[model samples]
Target: MSDYDFELPDARIALRPAEPRDAARLLTSYADGRLEDRIVRDLPQILAPGDRLVVNDSRVIPARLVGERLRPAGTARVELTLLVEDEPLRWTAFAKPAKRIGEGDTLRFPVPGGVVEGRVEARTGPTVTVRFAADPLAAGAMPLPPYIAAKRAPDARDESDYQTVYADPPGSVAAPTAGLHFTDRLFSALAERGIGLSRVTLHVGAGTFLPVKTEHLNEHEMHAEWGTVSAATVAEIAATKAAGGRIVAVGTTSLRLLESAAGEGVLAPFTGDTRLFIRPGFRFHVADALLTNFHLPRSTLLMLVAAFAGLARMRAIYAHALRHDYRFYSYGDASLIFADPR
Candidate 1:
């Protein structure tokens, strides 16, 4: 855990995304310890023709809700960030002022037309299971990362800015930040360059924003995220590999799902929950290269990247990013890292 810790200045964090999305800076970190400063739009020139880019198509849902909890004395303001849907109109969420909420308490969230009501079904620590009278999407707001939300409120711009253009399956509480750099114009360029594109689904959970609480890496337990790699995607990746092409994962989410599905030494269609905690010394079976964002210090994401590239190399890369004034975190700059040879 100490190996992953680093000092990052607060001003380096980006509050808003780059204009046009593809204009964000990209740092190419090579296994040979070479680094190149580039932009997101340069992907066509950066990647080869036969290379396949696997992207996560998981959509960010408006999961944050501000409501009032009915109390015997009076109503108290409550906040909930929906984590996962257990059933139709039923969800597990993290409640603010968790001590104030109780089982059987009614939650009322005001929406455009009216209020969306809910009943607390269960509570465990700060998290609660609630069954709503109707879909809460109507009253919910975009759930921004805690680092960003602490600074500013989620607004109209975030609704479009926080989501990828190809987002289809609505489940994720957070955006796959690396994929946020892509746009239609960039997609056209990749397509024209003959770089094949594939999609997988990994509903990024709110756990992605949680901090590493344990002292040692092994002591930390990862939150299970629902993901799927379909048969079509598996075939595409296999064909790309057979043709001597690289599998470039657009983000860690896609990379994790691909690795989870390929645990048998060969890629197979997979659909289920995954709690894959990738730290240093982990073996790589898929994803020849990775395009991802600069993660927080001591974060699981940073550890995974360190595992993919070498730890020393990652430290050097991060130092370069900081020295060069590169933006950090979600809605920040990106890094395309080529994995160390197996």
Candidate 2:
């Protein structure tokens, strides 16, 4: 635990989608926590010619499952959100109506092939274990964050909108949302302008949106996320650093992978799990800027923002956002934060 605590109002919550991908507002903050406001479409205007924008390309799988209860007659309707798929058949999930759902309880999902079945193998509070009847990846629904609840459950439309064009490796339970702003057109435009793009992969997982309940920051436990930093990306980052170009991570997921895999002293290649909980005192290894969405209050994401920008500065910026009615969360508005080495 750390002493990073703040308040965010309910009204700041964004309940809908931006009309155009880039139509949403953008807020960029300096290392010292200075803030500048701009629209997402104008991002190219503010960025320098040599800046490198790194994005996480991890694809978001459909992880939300809707099905009827099969055990104990008259079982109520249930929703199971998959947290991690161990294989084609096994998974760890967080289920609603978790009380009656226990080991061996049968669950089902709809698909053209028929019902995708599963069995609850474990249960703890709201979380549950699910052993799937088939490949969970092919049938699960996109686990959209609670704040951006959909009018209807995830469908084919989310197949494209919730994922970035560059997504490759499929592992993340949640989308690396800030990347959602970059249309192929926007990316092409930036590329044409010589604004370099880089990539890192940190599979977004269950820990990302969980609330920080403990008052003592040190007691907070971070969940491990799998990540990979390619050698080519490392070399590109080094070149960017050497040439005086800013390394702008597209999302906090990319930022975490970069910082966890590289060194404060110099960039390096890495592959492993990261439970790296970045706080105020942590020195950054990669990234000079961040493109992200506003996060839940009392969440680790907010803590990360607080660390990037000073706590007080972030507070003011967030307050301004709240006052101006900026949309918040995974499908919400975006922010461009500059990470100048302090």
Candidate 3:
């Protein structure tokens, strides 16, 4: 775990996303140990004509909420970030000031026209199961990563800035940041270059933002995220691979789902929860290349890239990114890493 740690300056954190989306910087880390700096729009030139880009199309919902716990005397303020829909109208959420909330307590969240209410079903640590009288999505705000939300509150801009242009199904609480770099223009350019695009679904949970607290990597437990790879997507990938095209995962979420579905060394249709943790020594059957954002030091995300592109290579990539003044984290620069053949 210590080997994955690196010092990052506070200034490198991007408070907001790049305008036009495709204008963000892109760092290409090749298998030959060469690094090149480019922008997101240069993807068409970087990737080969036959390569297929598999992207996560899961849309982010308004999951962060500020509600009041109706009390006998008055009301206590509580903050909750919905993690997953355990059942219909029942959600598992992480609550701030959890001590103020209890099982069976009523929580009232303000929506556009009226207030929506919920009853706490259960509590475990900071996580609580709440059954809402109405869909809570309407009463919440976009759940920004804690690293950014701690500095500033989510605004009207975040409702769009935090989501990807190709977002479809509404499930994820957090956006697949890597996909945030793509725009309609970039998609058109990729198509013109004959680079095919495919879609997967991975509803990112709040657990993605949780820091790895264990001293030993083996002891860490990964949070499960719901995802699916349709039969159509499987056939698309198979056709691309058959044509000698590379599989370029647009984000870690897409990579994880593809890898999860291909666990038997064959990609297949899948729909379920996955706690697949990609670290060093984990054999990868899919994802020839990965286009992702710079991750935090000692994070599972960092470990993942290191596994894809040798640890030594990823270290150099991060060093170069920091030295060249590239931004870091969710709203920062992107990196296109080719898998290490070794």
Among all windows of 10 consecutive residues in model 1, the one with the lowest summed lDDT is 208-217
RMSD of each: 1.0, 2.3, 1.2
Error of 3 at 286 (Å): 1.1
Where model 3 places Cα greater than 4 Å from the true spot, the runs are none
Best by TM-score: 1
Between 2 and 3, whose lDDT is larger? 3
lDDT agreement with native, every candidate = 0.93, 0.79, 0.93
| lDDT tens readout by residue for model 1, 1-342 | 778888889899999999989999999988788999999999999999999999999999999999899977899999999998899999999999899899999999999979999999999999999999999989999999989999999999999999999999999999998999999999999999999999999999988877698997888989999999999999999999999999999999999999899888788999999999988888889899999999998888998899899899999989999999999999999999998675
- The TM-score values for the models, in the order shown, are 0.98, 0.92, 0.97
What's the TM for model 3? 0.97
Write out the backbone clash pairs for model 1. none
- For model 2, what is the error of residue 253's alpha carbon versus the real structure, in angstroms, after optimal superposition? 0.6
Between the candidate structures 1 and 2, which one is better when assessed by lDDT?
Answer: 1
